[model samples]
Target: MATGFYTHPDCLLHDTGDGHPERAARLQAIEDQLIGSRIDIALQRETAPLASETALLRAHSAAHVAAMRACVPATGQAEIDADTFVGPHSWNAALRAAGAALAATDAVIDGHLDNAFCCVRPPGHHALREQAMGFCLFNNVAVAALHALEARHLARVAVIDFDVHHGNGTEAILAGDPRVLMCGFFQHPFYPFSGVPPLAPNMLNVPLAARSDGAAMREAVTREWLPRLRAFAPQMIFISAGFDAHRDDDLGNLGLVEADFAWLTRCIREVAAHSAQGRIVSCLEGGYALSALGRSVVAHVRELADL
Candidate 1:
């Protein structure tokens, strides 16, 4: 089996704005890097389907999904927040984003792939169950976790979020769902401040100090996240892999580099190998520096694909 690469052309069509950080070029950068690497392992490229109503319901309310669909303007962009925007293509792109996650989960769990990477826009992490913010329309990782529990009949799943900002949306969606354990490490005192308050016993949210760099991140994983994750002994793993913490990325104060992203992937792989048969699916969340973003994603996916 190979690592599935899940994406769609419509994902690029979800345009933010000319100067927005969540631009289409971010996906282009990742695609270019992957193409340039020539990492020789079977690559399963697939078009992402729209997530089913049932899948959406796993993580979000039907009313929330309906309202998001309704907010899709006929021709122009709708500003959902100071940092969030939805153009005409936004609705379908978000669907594909969440859909790609579900597709990846199914691939790994069904023995169709070793693991998967979802490269889509409107990066999810800040999206709550009902509110869209922080350039996120849907909580992709949470949706994937829910799919694993409900559709795949998995008893327990886990979500590992290594983004610079906390995955407040994922927490909102999956909190108190005993079927899932979520371990998140994010730079503290950042935008959309949350993730420190544990919503459930299954949730392990580790907040690192700003400008802490990779050593601090590694420590958080070793001391905080890894123990909780291993204790939960999840049936599958999902990652909200965000690169905005990269030293070159200006969105956050953290000074992590590509090595940090690769290191985190290695750690996640270790636990997945031990407990979940390496069933891991990663989705793009936030990365502002296009060049660093490209390099970091390549490192992360290279590890996921074991290239």
Candidate 2:
């Protein structure tokens, strides 16, 4: 079967404001590229469901949820942090972003699809359990990991984050849980610099220097992430797919390209095939440059779909 694709129109309606890097145009760029390349016809498409408060509580605090809801503006955008903002539609968009992750997990687990991709906006890896920061309002992948464990009755799961910045929120949420093994690579001394020491035993946080390229990433994966992931033997895999590491993106200096994203995706698939029954649910995290983000997503999804 084709890979499952989940998204929502509300995602595009989450307006960050003028000149914001994380804008609705990012998704449009991706869809335009897929349609231009005719890849959209080869995948299974579904509208994302709204994440319930119960599901949101799986990875977030009720206080946090209430606080974010309170921040929702009735007329214009309200800045939650120095970088994060919430418009009238931001709350629902965040819900749909996380909901897409949960829905994707259910689809993969129920045998409706082998793997799935959630192309929703307002990336989630940076949002902590109690605060929204770094352009993220909800921790989507964390919610999905918990869903696979608690709801789906899976004993073990893995989360792989390859964003340019560390997944501080994901680490905060699932760090000590033995049932979850989180592995990630991010540029050192980058935004939300907390992975340098790696707080949790279940985390395999590999920090690459600025300007490092895919060769360095390959080395990290082969030497660090793959071995740990194989030993963990996850029953399902969750990916915090972030494309800002691409060289063309000005967000960071990791120097990754479309080929690098594709290679890492293939590596993840190999590990999933070995241990996770080939089940993978990937969610978008970050990627600013429109062209690079679109191209990198196509490469990653193409590999995920094996098309």
Candidate 3:
């Protein structure tokens, strides 16, 4: 079966203003690279829909949803925090970004697709249950994990995040859930820092020092993430895939390269094949440097699509 590719044009409409790294051009770069590499040809393309309130409620408080909707300006943009902003179209764009995650989960879990990738912006893993921050409005992966458990009746699930920064919000939302096992590495002593203490017994957050390279990442996966993930024996796997850790990206000091992303994806695939029946759902998170982001995503999708 083809790998499902979920995206929506509306994602570009949620502008972050000039000089912001999380701009619309990020998604364009990924698409352009996929097209240039002909990876798009093998994908099962699907337009992302608007996520329902019921779905959002699974990961966010109703008050949080109402507050975010109120923050959307009728025109121009509204800043939700130092790093997050909402333009007139942001509400719809956020819904579609999150909806794409849910749709990817359904496609993979229902056996309609082998696995899926959600190319979304306003990158999640930062937004909490009650607030938006760090360039995120909704926890897309968190929403999908909840949907997989409640809607699909899956008893166990796992979330692996590999952004340059810790998934503070994802942990804030999913830390204590007995059905979820969250694991990954991030550059510590960085922005929104809060994963050092292993938020909950279920969270396995490894901190990478500044300038740490692919070797460090690989070691963490082998020594920390994989052992816990294997013991958990999740029925499905979700990835908060972030490429900002790339050495080419100026946003962070991590030294990861395209090959590193491929290696990690392959590792995740192996875990899925062992316990999840090859089920995996990956969603785009943070990657600033355009060229690096594009190439890294190509490598990741190549592994995911097994092309």
What are the per-model C-alpha RMSD values against the true structure?
1.3, 0.7, 0.7
Residue runs of model 2 more than 4 Å from their true location after superposition: none
Q: Count clashing residue pairs in model 1.
A: 0
- The digit string of per-residue lDDT tens for model 2 on 1-307 reads 6699999999999989898999999999999888877789988998999998998999999999999889999978899888998899998999999999999999999999989999998899998899899999999999999989998899999999999999999999998999999999999998898897988899999999999999999998999998899999999999999999999999899999999999999999999999999999999989999999999999999999998
Error of 1 at 84 (Å): 1.0
What TM-score would each prediction reach against the true structure? 0.97, 0.99, 0.99
lDDT of 1 by residue, 161-232 (tens): 888899999988888988888888788888778876878887898888888889988887899888888888
Better of 1 and 2 by lDDT: 2
Q: Each prediction's Cα lDDT score?
A: 0.87, 0.93, 0.93
Give a tens-digit lDDT track for model 3, residues 151-219. 999999999999999999999999889999999788988987789898799999999999999998898
Off by over 4 Å in 1: 40-42
| Model 1 whole-model lDDT (C-alpha atoms) | 0.87
